[model samples]
Target: MARAPKDHKTNALRELDAAGIVHEALFFDADPAMTGVQIAQSQGEDVDAVFKTLVTEGKSGEHYVFLVPVACELDLKKASAAAGEKSVAMVRARDLLPLTGYVHGGCSPIGMKKRFATFVDETAQLFDEIYFSGGKVGCQVRMAPDDLALLVPFAYADLTA
Candidate 1:
């Protein structure tokens, strides 16, 4: 099937294009209740190739972002160490919109309201390209890990357990 021209551009997708990073947006049906795992599974995508964006607040009130593979859990201990904080906690769902300009099911590390310290799971290094929410629930953007790092200002670490 032929893919349609990119019309419904999200901030995330626009940022990618502005940075000169090539990416493809794949559309799928997802619910607010669906996790990254569920989205990948329902879309017949390889779980290892899909990532979830999570936001956390450090003890110093600094916000941090992590992109981990869909099938894994973010290791809080590892996350804290990566962020140079003694502890970190997920940002409240209610705060996500105000903080990142995104809702619970559609947060993307790219084009956030403010630049948060961002990190990607070391496993992302294993894939040339990975899929993450295109700042929306149904649009998945697939791009090279290197490209993502360049556009999002991120580091790679052992973020998942």
Candidate 2:
């Protein structure tokens, strides 16, 4: 028998379920040292279809979220523009858990301490489904961009460098 999603419950998964968003939860052996790209490679997932969730603090003191391919760099200028901020900076690692309710490597755009304006790289739309951390290290969630948008209300933008 297959394990149920509740067996691997995480804030991200719970939110998806509550929103009626269909998604697949994938669990893997998590090495603390592995980068997002390495995690994707370990699972035989395409680098471009595995996204990393990032949180940033804008000049106005507002927070925002961005999802980019695991192997790409977020273009800060583009990110600032997309978020309508004069500039944006990554939230300090020490503050991540408190601010987002997730650790650095486990952050997911789906369920945050509070919803911030979220954006996904435009390239994500090219794939049928994209994967991201399922609110914890060693777990991932796969869903269509449209489903994600409906659940989280994100916009697609040129977010990667």
Candidate 3:
């Protein structure tokens, strides 16, 4: 029921609206002090149902987006293999803003300036619904995994343990 503040607009949210994607936005204490796992716990949601967006660079110097459950870690090897790349490394926090047009902790896979090779952890299919950042800290959007997959350009792969 919580919606983003009127003054704070993000490209991700705008894209969702433009696409007619139905999503519920929720807000928690804007505590930059907590991690994604901590926020999920405080919200009384299963940690596994919460996902975090990660940006990685392939050996080819291409950026890729990885969405994995908060409960699991992104296996760079699996991700690279899925993308048919040699290897992958995390993008530095400082670099994320310019690359994705989103700040760290608020980078959603939606509304990127340009679509990169995106990968969704196959484990995400296990959940009926999942929560992801609404392109801003303290704000989250819940939607069906299938819906997300449909809206975002991504491939499903076993990128997690």
The true-structure Cα RMSD of candidate 1 reads 1.9
- The TM-score between candidate 2 and the true structure equals 0.94
- Clash pairs detected, candidate 2: none
| Best-fitting candidate, scored by TM-score | 2
Q: Per-residue lDDT for 1-161 in model 3, tens only? A: 35557655677777777888888777766778888888899899889889999999999999999999887889889998998999999999999989988899999898877788888888778888889988888788888888886678788899986
lDDT of 2 by residue, 32-138 (tens): 99988888898899999999999999999999999999999999999999999999999998999999999989999988989999999999999999999899878
Model 2 root-mean-square deviation:
2.1
Assess candidate 2 and give its lDDT: 0.90
**Model 2: runs farther than 4 Å from truth?**
1-7
lDDT of every predicted structure (CA atoms): 0.87, 0.90, 0.85
Sorted by lDDT (best first), the order is 2, 1, 3
Error of 1 at 142 (Å): 0.2
lDDT of 3: 0.85
